[model samples]
Target: MEKKTYIQAFCTIENNKIVLNGETVFESENTGFADFSKKAYQHFEIGYPKFFKMDNLSKLAFLGSELLLKAQNPNDENNTALLFANKSSSLDTDVKYQNSISDKENYFPSPAVFVYTLANICLGEISIRHQLKSENSFFIFDAFNAAFMADYANILIETQKAKNVLCGWTEFFGEDYKAFLYLVGNEGAIENTKQNLEILYNK
Candidate 1:
């Protein structure tokens, strides 16, 4: 008999609020994603200095993953896979980098800003923090595809490629941003399914 997969924990961030496992952990009147992300890092007592240098997309995903990972505390780090997706595809940072070079008089392309032009940089940041070198991938869709994430994660687990999957949708652009991350493992309170993922994402 195959072991059934379950969602061990989840976190959602949006509208200047952070919710871990359905309970609000942090909230702020600061509507800006940068301010709210900084507040979240402070509130969680995160000591990662690199977090300060990340783009908004990376910050959003990092914070959400931090919340879920802290809750589950998975021991088999190398056996965990990261599956993340978004719609904007780093356009936020792309614009910033573009603007930096857009001025011919001030033609300066920041290496710091240029590195975050890829949406997968957030996954790299998270993987580096947790020392996770397992299977990972990032996708962009017209909208959140809960079904694809659920199926792909389960496939990895079923094939023994990974013991657990940390997956989510992190979207950030301009003044709008949202993050929904969940941990799927062999045991947990919620079964890992498309419907469950969609419900958690919507919540």
Candidate 2:
């Protein structure tokens, strides 16, 4: 079987910043991871209350889930999620988790804090949010490699396993974070070049 192709993508960063269909949805001051999570939810129109209460990984996942679903085909069920690349790795929540243990005389490990330790938890959080029961995988890359991403998406689609593959780079490094997601489908919008991807990222 031949591999499927890409349809649409939604990217966002710290401070209510967003890039939907290669366009900006919201732009604001970039800050620490927690604050970024709050601002990101607002961009998705999920309001502050609901946003603030969500766990760190949950927040990241929810934002990614919302973007992909918005661009999805209503009847599509053969979906897959493939998230790739880099840091902070729940550092914000980890700090809190460690603090909770040290600050208290009794010392208790927070289940919530422990959950966000793995980077893939973000993907799981998204899956739970969207009820996405398809295949999912996460990878860490030093930087966005368009070729590798394209190849991975192609493999999933060509296997006759998945009709759509949500692929991208989502990394959080301390005070900086970036999320770039593409809803890859057999039939949909196309961004067929590396230059194009780089161009979008640069802008």
Candidate 3:
């Protein structure tokens, strides 16, 4: 018999709102990402100072992961793989970084901003926070590929490469941003399927 996996919990953040397990946990309508994320951080009372130092994309992923990981921490951090995808792929920060060094007269490049130029950096932030030392990868797709994500996570779990898989799409670019993160393990109410993933992602 083949081992089965399920989505234990999921969180979504977009349109200035944070939703976890089908509940609107936090939201700020008139605020931008900076203010909204800061307020969300405060509401959750996440006391990590490094959170403020991260770029927007990292901040977005951090907020979503915080809810899921904290809610039902898988206990085995060493084997929880992180698989995240995004359409923008750090272009948001790339644009900002470009502006910094674009002006030859100004010629200013910030290491802090330059650090987040890759989308996978968000996974690094999550790993450090959760102390996860398993496999992790960041994919850049034109759109959310639920089928691929489902397959990849299943392989990781089935092959025993990871005990639990943190998977989702986290896209952040300027005023537009969306994040959907779910935990895949041996137990949960929702089965890990492409169709189910699409439903959860579209929901």
Candidate 4:
């Protein structure tokens, strides 16, 4: 029999709050995504110094995955897959980079800022942190396409291309941002399905 996929763990970040497995772990009054993410990182005692250098979008994605994978760290990083999606893509960083070069007077496009102008950069950051060297992809949509993510992750697992799948929707634009990440494995409380993903994402 084919192994059944389950949601091993999940995390949600929005409204300056971080929720892990339906439990509120971190909340801050900070109005901006940058501040809120920093607070959560400090609260969690995440020691990765590189996190401080990431842009707002990468910070959001990193924190969300960090919380979700806290307890369920993968043993086989090579067989783990990362599937992520968002609505805004990299508009937030694009604007910042554009502004840096737009002014001839300034003419200062920081490489640090330019590096994160692509939405997939967050995936690269996460993979580097986790040492995950497996299949990875990023998608952009008008809204969270829970069905596609669920089905695609299952396909990875079913084909034996990946033993585990870390997937989510992380959207960041200015002060408005949200990240919902979940780990799919062969055992857990909730089955990995589109409906369950949508429900968890909504919750």
Instruction: For each of the candidates, give the backbone clash count.
Output: 0, 0, 0, 0
- What tens-digit string does per-residue lDDT give for candidate 4 at 1-203? 25569898899999988889999988899667767777788899999999999998899999988876667654756677999999999999999899999899989988889899999999999989988888999999999998898889889999988999999899999788889999998778999888999999999
| Deviation of model 1 at 59, angstroms | 0.6
Candidate 2: C-alpha RMSD after superposition = 3.2
Least accurate 10 contiguous residues by lDDT in model 2 = 1-10
Compared with the true structure, the alpha-carbon lDDT of candidate 2 equals: 0.65
Model with the higher lDDT, candidate 3 or 4? 3
Backbone clashes in model 1, listed as residue pairs: none
Ranking by lDDT, best first?
3, 1, 4, 2
Which residue pairs show collisions in model 4? Answer: none
- In order, the Cα lDDT scores of the candidates are 0.90, 0.65, 0.92, 0.88
Compare candidates 2 and 4 on TM-score and give the better one: 4
Candidate 1: tens digits of C-alpha lDDT, residues 129-200: 988999999999988898898888888899999999999899999988888999998888999888998899
lDDT of 1 at 126: 94
Better of 1 and 2 by TM-score: 1
Candidate 2: list runs displaced more than 4 Å. Answer: 1-4, 29-36, 39-43, 47-53, 101-106, 191-195
